[model samples]
Target: MIFFRSLLVAMLVILSAYTAVVVGNHGMNLLTVFFADMAAIEWPGQFNLDFMFMLALSALWVLWRQGISLSGIGLALCAFFGGALFLSCYLLVLSVQTNGDVRKMLLGRHMPAHS
Candidate 1:
């Protein structure tokens, strides 16, 4: 559990720093570049497409785990746009809340811990 927490913190810090640098250099034109690569039939575009689906899946999981309520919908949006930035922080907080219960962390607070 400690290891997981540490890893999540590290991921959060690294990704946040990297994202800052990227935004600093690129000036927030991610969507244009992201789609342009795909439109041009490039490997980056393929990877972006794959990554986009993965983000969607992450958002879906967040919604499912939250029982699809209004808050769940908001969280799903964050999960979609925020990517690992949202997830690492979410899991980090959940780890503390659940006292290192891996199943609970993945399954949600309302679920039985063991099931």
Candidate 2:
């Protein structure tokens, strides 16, 4: 479990770094290209719609897991705007905090093991 989580952390870190460099080279107008694709008549538009759904879902899940308070809103915004960057970092830290107990790390609640 720890090994897999460590692998994911490494992968996300590399991907994030690469993406940052690419974005830096391209500039913020890259996001305009990103947004422009949403109007396409094929897979790109579909993918963007799917991503938007998942984006909203992630924000809602963040709110659900955290709460309806200030911190909850803050986390939801992070989950909304940060996307996988926030999720990967959040999960890595959460897994560490929960000692790699996947259920507690993911579900935010503990369950009794059946005998």
Candidate whose TM-score is highest: 1
lDDT, model 1, position 43: 93
Q: List clashing residue pairs in candidate 2.
A: none
lDDT of 2: 0.78
Model 1: runs farther than 4 Å from truth?
Answer: 113-115
Candidate whose lDDT is highest: 1
lDDT of 1 by residue, 5-87 (tens): 99999999999999999999988999999999989888999999999999999999899888778999999999999999999
lDDT for position 108 in model 1: 88
Error of 2 at 34 (Å): 2.6
Clashes of 1: 0
For candidate 2, what's the RMSD? 2.9
lDDT accuracy of residue 4 in candidate 2: 70
